[model samples]
Target: MTLRGERQADFAYQAVYRYMINLINEVSTDTRVKLPSLRQLSQRLNVSISTIQYAYSLLEKEGRVYSVAKSGYYAWPLSGSPSTLPSGDLLERLYVAARRPGMVVLSADEPALLASLDATLLRLERELVRQHPRHLQSWSQPCGVWELRAALAARYTSSPSRCWHADDVYIGADLRGVLDILIEVLGLRGSTVIVESPCDWLILRLLQDAGVRIIELPWAPDGRLDLPALEGTLIEETVQLVLLSSAVSLPSGVAMQPFERLEVARLLEQYGCWLLENDTYSELGFQPQQAALRDLVNPDRLVVFSCFEKILGPEAPYGYLLSRHMSGELQRQFLLRSFRLSSIRQRAIARLYHSGQIDQHLNTLRQLLREQAGEMSQRLDHHLGDQVTYRMPSGGATFWLGSVHAVDMRQVFQHLLARQVVVAPGELFSLGGLHSQHVRLSHTFHGQPNLEIALAALGEALRQAQLG
Candidate 1:
């Protein structure tokens, strides 16, 4: 089926699902409610019977409803009111508060290396503009600067499985923009996607905004991918895409082993699922580069989305999407809606990458991050020892912390916010509201003296909540 047709069909199923949920909610909780029949609902809702069936099947999988042979689907009795998922409203508030002047933002996800690279990037940007004045005379090519695309494509060409070319690379303003284009061009709306539990908040927000259903695959306590759970989910759910950081998972900061990547690749191939590999944090791994999942998954089934923001700093916010199978139509749709990135910045980054300066910068950045991670872990142990639990990050910038005792992280967030400290409550990470007692803290601001004060305050707030 065409992408647009699949999207429309999924939308129909979602409409029917929501309608059923509303209907089920209206009935008494003490008794079971027989749902409208597929034929009846199809006629009533002006949708095909197959759409209704698809909706019912999803509801059955979710345990919202059940079916008996020769009988219509029926709503299961409610145990209590359905729990509300964390809204973007709270996330927005936290983000805004985090950026307030003088606020101690332990919730930051951006790398601290950005500040150190300003002078170098500025110099490079100026040099590019001076040497390439003609770039200003014309609009950037629809696919972005050819040099940039070529440079990016060259990185993946070494993998025999991924014979990527410049045409296969599409650059956008940033990672989020690239993702938005992918969602639109791929017609991911109303489709189901599997994401890591405690996934990137931006990713979760974008998926939710696109009207996509998200299934979160949580990490095992030992910080490994729960392969069995992932396999079970793939078996049970009609998941269209799986989005994850194959090298280093966010929030948790756990790097996947080669075997784990191989297993995930195997499952994705077996289930015929598209993989959106977020390689944004791959360079931050403490150990040597692990095997790439791209080498394991079919090239056509994998789309790599990465950006220069973490490495080159937010000043050069450019992201590229790499896939061996980008169709002409998909490229056309992307060009029509996507913003053109700065030609000067693209050239500058391309120069940086080709000059091998990026590798040198990465080596320095990785060491800084490692030191910061250790410092953050030590501080956490000092202030909140035994009060909160967290896995010391293997890579990436943040720590996923769980309160040892029952405590509402949202409440902690609000409490800390009043004191000019901002924290990302774990509720923002999942659709199921499963991480209410957890919070994601970043080591980005480890060098700041106020970070220690913020951790102390956080420790106090968590202790109070535990006592209450």
Candidate 2:
């Protein structure tokens, strides 16, 4: 039997709704049993609350469930034999498989230049000896080591807008910590912040856990900023800041157009909202660089942030925040929170930047990533054929793929995980419903041969899933 209002076409919300139906059938052995709350179900299923509500509405229309005004949905178990929900063990097993050491992991955020990291670290070691003993002994000033800041300043001065200065740079050992501090420093608590749906999952999770009031704007499938919607939202809500990834977005690797960035800045200025531009993957672009919002927007209204993890390695993860509107009190607050900085590490990074090695490394890294992305895309196309579709990432390490047919991504993720192949479920990237059949694959972790093997394995898994 088919579900009412169900269509055969692929859509994220429909997929989630169908899954909810199956879940009710699989569970609901007793009548009037309360279903999980929308928030609870959303978190458990990695879907959005709106998706759950839509599914519930459909179920209510079909008389499969009933809702209490202030309570929640409840299943109406029919007499005689009854069906039960799928075992919760499904997701448990999937996460466990993802953790296996030898799994064909495609969700890794590791750098593509894996082999060259050792060489870079060795160079850092060599450069570290040149720093004065006194500099190493004392605590780094809150603004960070002067040499590193100066190096960062030099790099930014090369851009179209030569506004960055040594004093404008602030270093943080942990990117997330720095961001949290920035949010507080900006006095944005209890204020509405706008973020893109399907943004960096880690960042999304961080914001959620921090209890920030967020308004997530759904990104169009084509990867452009929904400006009209954004402006509408700004008009309707009081937004303190807009967190944007202007270079390459996570999962999708889609870049914002140059004009779009400028327009977004203009809108933010008009609405009196600050723009925190995250350009972490900007250096990975394969073509000529596009203009950044930092160059287009008034410096007082825009603060740019990026980390070394993409260019350097995970072991050396430090980030720099550049802002022109920072006040003495704000700087002091930031410094007060971070009493000590890693002087040695800062000096090493400074050497890499000052000696031009950073640029040379980036030139090579970008080419390597481009080749890896190409290999992954070609392999998927050759093996999966029409079963899957994906766009070749222009920058960043991940490719967001959508299934060509109706398939439960959760089941597919499980099947692939059982075979020790790991991919990120699309639902994990958004706060609400998404293209549920979508999955994310990372190309930075493996070389061509291993990538080919993983793709072949994934193709087999897809075939199996389709058959079932």
Candidate 3:
């Protein structure tokens, strides 16, 4: 073959090969991902048609990708996975993940921690110059920055006490980083992971993608996991880690009651199992009176993850994990995957958090959300008597919703989307049949124009979907 031909082939192969690796990481490994058509990809990437086809062929030969007759190339479902996924210092990954298309993220329960950053930007710049203008030039050292970690410890503000130290805190860039760290520290392979039924879609998708066997702990009204059902599932499933939401469970917005947490923590401690507390939405609370699972117990079995995305908005890039023991291996994995977030951002976050605007905005937002959420709740209540079920969280931004079984939420979703009304479908939360009759509503018609009008349109769609 000519050198030009070989070179073109190699470039195409490299491109397609890279795409496959990213596909596995970005999309789930347990599911099939439709690859773009050769012509489509070529047009988009400014590559030649033959190159795209040749690249796919090379990937197919190597078992990275496959093609079905009469169908397009698709990335093969992965197992355990290769080291092809990019490893960055964390900041780069954070920037990139934040920029992805359709990330219209309303899934994780991150609070808006960066409002402080906005409020403090001018002063923060001055402080940076005064304290350490060359901060960006410095490399992140052992145990992360002391001040940043200390700020994180202070930010958490646990009810009883801070169970962690400034040295104990390390900030990564969202749920993904926290998960990677926990997975590394915990040695999760071949281990059963427990998730609540109707949990965060991304969490479900991530664990599902990793080939993790999942046990759906029943999430009842009081944010209590159905004990009998969970015990039976645990015995039957050999659950290794129990992912609980102490402060703010995503999508559901239900915080585990203190008593329920005490019971669950005891059960988990007895089993010698681990609990991953996702308090990502903890900051959404405006009330001074709320409990955290981490606060109620001191068991070595729990690791809590909280992030800064929900209220402050997406790509704000900060997540922290407080564990009983952070192993060297775990730290290694975090440092290795650290490409997803930046120390610069973490540094700024430390400064902003210290400035205290996050607390102030959170208070304002909490009051606003409480009032708005109540309005929406009343609207939902008025519309559907038993046709819909929802959580009226004492605090936090999102809530769990269940609709009448007769309502095919998918159809309702499609109909509403056609009408430009966006709402999270219930199936995203459940393990199929059980949650098919629900939809979580996070946005309320608080300020924007025609709020009631849009909701009415969606309500009509719901009526049709249910009635039909």
Best by lDDT: 1
Cα deviation of 60, candidate 2, in Å: 46
- TM-score per candidate, chains pooled: 0.79, 0.74, 0.71
The parts of candidate 2 lying over 4 Å away from their true place are 1-99, 114-118, 134-136, 158-162, 445-450, 463-468
The global Cα lDDT (0 to 1) of model 3 is 0.59
- Please estimate how well model 2 matches the true structure, expressed as its whole-model Cα lDDT: 0.69
- Write the residue-wise lDDT of candidate 3 on 1-468 in tens digits: 122333332134455557656664676565456688877876666554544555564454344665543356666545412222124322222222222233222222333422323444445544654565443334444335567788877765554455566756766645555676677577776678888777776677567656677777757766666877767766766788988776656566666666777787667766777778777666665456466666655546667776665655532435667664765665676666533233344566677677786666677777777776777677667755556666687566555676655777767765654454556666666554456776766543335565566557666877888745
lDDT of 1: 0.75
Q: Can you tell me which runs of candidate 1 are displaced by over 4 Å? A: 1-88, 114-116, 135-137
lDDT of 1 by residue, 1-468 (tens): 122233343245566778788887787364556778987887787665544665675565455666544356767655422121113367656644543456677787877443356567778877766786642434447678888899988877765555788889888755766787889877789999998887877788788889999998888768889999999999999999998885888888788888899899999999999999988888888889877777788787888899877776645656778877756865786567534345666777788889998888888888888888888888899999989888888887889998999987777887897777888988888877878888998887635978878989998899777645
Question: What shift in Å separates residue 451 of candidate 2 from its native position after superposition?
Answer: 3.4
Q: Mind giving the per-residue lDDT tens digits that candidate 2 earns over 154-254? A: 77665555567888888775576567667777777677889877777667666765677878887677778799999999999989889888577666777
Top candidate (TM-score): 1
